[model samples]
Target: MIVENSKVILSVKNLTAEVEGVQILKGVNLEVKAGEVHAIMGPNGSGKSTFSKVLAGHPDYAVTGGEVIFKGQNLLELPPEERSRAGVFLAFQYPLEIPGVTNSDFLRLAYNTLQKQKGLAELDLLDFDDYVQDKLKVVEMNPSFLSRSVNEGFSGGEKKRNEILQMAILEPKLAILDETDSGLDIDALRIVSNGVNQLSTAENCTVLITHYQRLLDYIVPDFIHVMESGKIVLTGGKELALELESRGYDWITEEVKV
Candidate 1:
């Protein structure tokens, strides 16, 4: 469903950021258009995660320079909550477990918050339950999850599925999944990837930050970007993933040094 010449959903211009006074993202530039999926890949400290966090407005990371424009607005200007309401979704690598909040309540609150942003009526409990049931199917999650605490006592895969459920309900214009494939078994990976694929559409953009190419096997990206020392040193078509898998990142890093 990728439309050629679609509107740009995210634009990062010479972005530089740091955490705890140490630089992470340096001179990073990327552009994502509607309907396109992009994957960011590199070694452990390549700043792939930092880029995603900075996009989500993580306070820990300070933007020392550059700008991020989302949907034609200065992305860095909006607070975190406002970013979420503006249809920016970030599925964390490690989703936190809330001990007291029930899944149903948390999901409803999030959905209603977005509804309020749009000046739409919020769905009540019964109506919301019906609405959520449909969204749960996207992740093939069970209704029993609603009764449990948000991500509490859930398996790793279940936690990831829960994140996807949130994405299904919110239907954000831009979805940034940071290392979502981490700590997942084959079955879990397949299920989660399928859920992500189901949620993708012609009007939304997906950015996946991953290490292994296996994840890309399931959720093929239109472009694959390689980050080295806080910069996107290389970008290519889906075939780049296979090359990286076969040759490892040494070639890419070495080429970057040239």
Candidate 2:
């Protein structure tokens, strides 16, 4: 578990959202600070993924109520692109394949866009090539991946690696990994976890949304939260994950109801 002096990076207050006219998140509240990793775990339909998407300002979900503050700004008010430029990153469970765009080009464009937003000069192609090469080492990805189309024909592990590689280059202040460990084998899981650990620092925070306790083993979290029926019903330290893994969520759910 990581600790900090307690500078809040994200503060969600009674966050309520819905998708396609169906309510999903129900007043979800959470607080994350720099230098800490928070894991949100729960069964299916618990609205874990919905919360992550809402933070990223996804278009499909509409915020019906509540407030979200990220780095002292009204997060819900920002557009998706603005959120990305503001150092909010989301590594999706399913990375899309862009057939026409090469990975190098895509990454460079994304990186340069964020750089421009930060009032930093955009790297030219020549300099960006050198920069991306260095980031590839973070994920231990092969150079050939840069030449191929984005996520095209890559294995499951490869796609996840690419997502981490993007995080490496982007250096986001808040990284939300939405079940990035879902389909990865043990080896890939370690590799991905290593990258995430390497990137985490006192200046940034990480939020992991996962279903299994296995991921918590590799990336130890400072806080473990149990989400059920669109709300966080319990919060504890790392040991809570082990408890949930052994006892299952039923007992916790029943206890919360009582």
Candidate 3:
């Protein structure tokens, strides 16, 4: 039985989805509780990105079966915009650049758009600006980020930090990050991870989808799940990431029947 007010915030049961009629997710199941970080580690072509996309209501993929419940709500039934308004946040691997959209304009609209969905009043430009300045301090980001177009001409490091900055401001109940450690130098990784860590609280959860164990060192997920062929084959604590790093995914691949 699933509880409406349980500590588990998101419940995914026997989830199966597809892209253009080709099945991608084959009965994937996961349970995420508040304040917990779950790292999904898998090899390339293992359907990690598919899982992230399906959760965000991307139309390119179709749900073949299963249920996704978020805080007692049917998540799959909602549209992508509604999904964002309802608290699902996905940080993309390759962020698109909008040359005309100012970063500050985008952030302000995103924050207030969410606020409106919750039946709360929207924050004016002044209030939102103040809030953004404070969040930038957390990532050691500069004020110049506000004036630039959204992700336009941003370095790899700047783009990742910008994603974290949005996460910090939106404060979604469930945040799904896909390969966030990619293209990041040591300093940028530290700054981005630090921002992510600071955003976590007793009321929110973080889900990291990554291929390498290097990211686990900074984020320190509460659970590590190994995915192969769209299903979780192994699960353990932080040490599992280390073990995978030592022995490699070969152990999991060899054990899994495919």
Q: Tell me, what's the RMSD of every candidate?
A: 0.7, 0.9, 2.6
lDDT of 1 at 62: 96
| Lowest lDDT 10-residue stretch of candidate 3 | 1-10
Candidate 3: residue 125 Cα off by (Å): 2.2
Where in model 1 is the C-alpha error above 4 Å? none
Highest lDDT: give the candidate number. Answer: 1
Candidate 3 residue pairs in clash (backbone atoms < 3 Å): none
lDDT-based ranking, best first?
1, 2, 3
lDDT of 2 by residue, 1-258 (tens): 366476899999999999999999999999999989999999899999999999999999999999999999999999999998888999998999999999999999999998888899999999999999889998899999999999999999999999999999999999999999989999999999999999999999999999999999999999999999999999999999999999999997798789
What's the lDDT for residue 228 in model 2? 96
> Alpha carbon lDDT of residue 29, candidate 1?
96
Q: Write the per-residue lDDT of candidate 1 for residues 1-258, one digit (tens) a residue.
A: 468889999999999999999999889999999999999999999999999999999999999999999999999999999999999999999999999999999999999999999999999999999999999888889999999999999999999999999999999999999999999999989999999999999899999999999999999999999999999999999999999999999988888889
> For model 3, what is the C-alpha lDDT against the true structure?
0.90
Alpha carbon lDDT of each predicted model: 0.95, 0.94, 0.90
What is the clash count for each candidate, in the order shown?
Answer: 0, 0, 0
Model 2 segments beyond 4 Å from truth?
none
Comparing candidate 2 with candidate 3, which one achieves the higher lDDT? 2
With a 3 Å backbone cut-off (N, CA, C), the pairs that clash in candidate 2 are none
- What digit string (tens of lDDT, one per residue) describes model 3 on residues 114-198? 8887889998988888888999987889989899999999999899899989988888999999999999999999999999989
Candidate 1 clashes between residue pairs 3 or more apart in a chain or in different chains: none
